[model samples]
Target: MTNTDVGITDDEGSTMTLGEGRTPLIPSTHDENLYYKHEGLNPSGSFKDRGTALTVSKALEEGIEKLHVCSSGNAALSLAVYTRRAGLECVCHVPEQTSESKKQLMEALGATLVEYDGVYEDIFHELREKDLDGWNVTPGVSNTSLEAYERIAAEILAQVVPEQVIVPCGNGTNLAGIWRGFEKHGESPAMVGVQMKGAAPIKKALEEEKSHAVVEDPGESLAEGIIASESFNCAEATDAITASDGRLEVITETELEAGLRELVREGILPEPTSAAVKPVADRYDGVTVAVVTGSGLKNYTELRELC
Candidate 1:
């Protein structure tokens, strides 16, 4: 299939575009059978671009003037760039304690940053009660986000057919979408979702065979992208993992550090969150493809320390 044939079409001829999707799938220098999906090369330097590209287009299609999201970082950055490109307004609701630099980056990307107090999830929940005018750009809350990530699987399939697809899973929306996409094409690859140890509620839930689990007082993690009190689409994500015969793997800080160094040495600088997949990918035989979720340049503060 052509790139257009596999990617999400600008259904109504929406103009919002950043050349999102069509990321290269390159074979890993470290492992002959392993390939890395260079998602960090996207305009916003993360996989969120695949989803944001579509979400912002939908907003334009509906004549929506504003959008809002609750994000710690990448999602907001993605939304900010896409929404700005689409001539729309985006407001990011971030934790009050979020770093000034992070908040400033969102603003720099053209998003209006709003600070929220109390539990991160609870604050968003309360905002939901407002019945806001714009779309909730949270990964799971947006149907477009889930549908958007399906395009990644399509892009990956067009490049190579691996025996397994590994994701550096955060809220699991991306993982759920990959399962949906592969299933749509009648391909069954063992999906592997990797997470940082402390904030791994999805891993815990899978072990318990439950719909979901909440991480109480999640420990400090090097992978800030995946930290969460509870994943927004836990049930859907859990169902996807179970149905695909996939299991969750948790990574500790030490392994995460090694993985970060390995990827960088191999000439790919990935954010710590994306590097969490290294150990998991190493364990699998056959053709395995791991999604490199974001750029280490954006997380230079932590990346510098880790290196």
Candidate 2:
């Protein structure tokens, strides 16, 4: 199925796409009841394309000629591709340490790049300092992107209505969006959010029963996609998790490494962070679908070293 079969349509009644949606839902190689929604197959090699396609389409229709975004890697790359396709200028500010593979491709897609010395929050802070305002296409911050992300759940329902959906949670928009999507269809599934140990502020906050808190000493992992030092959408994320009767998990470096090996053996090479759900999904009862957020190709070099 094409993205148009399952995505938001424009005012012209056509979904602007670069083959961004209708990703295949593949059965797992090991667990019979578990499946993988391989979003890495998206044009930008991450689920971020789903958001970019819709948001950029809406922006283009509104005569938006330029876009601004702050991303870890995948989001910037996806924005770069969509904006270029729309013939709009894109400026992306990303951490200096982003994977070279992702950064190089963003530039090749005609996005002007400004590298910063820290993580997403730091870069975003500096962007705020510049007093520059335009269309911000970051994945978790806007309504259109959330609407686009809801399509993932819609497609999953069409493919297989599992008892639960597992997602790698950074800011929790994808999890929340999917829950909302299922709600729009009048169905709800158990939502599960997983994060790498060091970067899981959401998990920590939930565990502590607090509204918002930062990890005092964050650790490093190759799963940079889901590694937000602190979450910006904590309330939205927690609300979704709470409303859906979903639970949170924090996986270790050992678990991330082992999960990567297990998933690779199962014929899925997810980025290290996206594999955070494998161990949990392996033990969950009933049908479960794990959303593999991005491809290992986004950081093949670092992943190979980790493996």
Candidate 3:
């Protein structure tokens, strides 16, 4: 994949090489013409590491002593690891329904985990309303994550020039980053955003041609991190999709399950969030790149059973 060395490194003099970034843009065995960006290889076992590291670092740079964030799973884990490294206190409000392993990882990294009863977005709103005592609140989907995704896009462009790029949509930060990264470099790749069927606000917005916040249902899926019903950047997401000549594709539970299974068969274990990108890959018939956003290890048992 096309990449910039400067974007991937965690600043200079940092020797923490979890071998993050520069992941393979592999040609699928099933279809030689297709490519996959195996982002599951990132440190902290998810693509969110890219953004979390940068966000945490920037927060530290700004002299923020403590941090708080609301997440479904992946982002919390990413922040936990990064904040621990940066010697910053972290308090994460996560959905009560998030995975056990994810919760364990958060605590293991020394983050104070507060489980909330309502939706993920509700927790974000709650955090926003409360007095954090000057704790740097990591916006659930910050622009810094886009910088991380930019590194991903840069690498993809370098490795193999693709006609299309697909990513799982949650807060739409990943899509926004990829769109902006390529655009900054004077490149335009057809960008497809995927969401779980009934949970897809981005797809709905595109279909309706207007963007609005959505309230998520109580039930949960394996793609816990992307269980967002409301997008902080709904209009921007809509604009990116329209501008890219791309569309949002929402996959049903059955379709998502199948997609998860396919990744395992190929020796890639994708978490629920990453599984959303699969159908988009299947739909497009070209040198398409689908970002496998997180490790199957996050949902290892579930994936193994399904496989």
Among the numbered candidates, top lDDT falls to: 1
The residue pairs in collision within model 2 are: none
TM-score, structure 3 vs. true: 0.91
- Candidate 1, residues 51-76, lDDT tens digits: the string is 88878877888889999888767888
Worst 10 residues of 2 by lDDT: 5-14
The runs of at least 3 residues in candidate 2 whose Cα sits more than 4 Å from the true structure, single-residue gaps closed, are 1-15, 208-211
Tell me the lDDT of model 1 at 193.
89
Across residues 1-307, which tens digit of lDDT does each residue of candidate 3 receive?
3135324344522233344666777778798767889888888888877777666666766788788888888878888888788788888888788888889989999999999887878787777778786464454435666666777777777777678889888888788878887787667888898877678888777777787657557256777756667776677677878888988887777888888888778777788779887776898887889998888787767876778
Candidate 1: Cα lDDT at 162: 81
Model 3 ranges off by over 4 Å: 1-19, 136-141, 215-218
Compared with the true structure, the alpha-carbon lDDT of candidate 3 equals 0.76
TM-score of each: 0.92, 0.91, 0.91
Model 1 residue runs over 4 Å out of place are 1-14, 96-101, 117-119
Count clashing residue pairs per candidate: 0, 0, 9
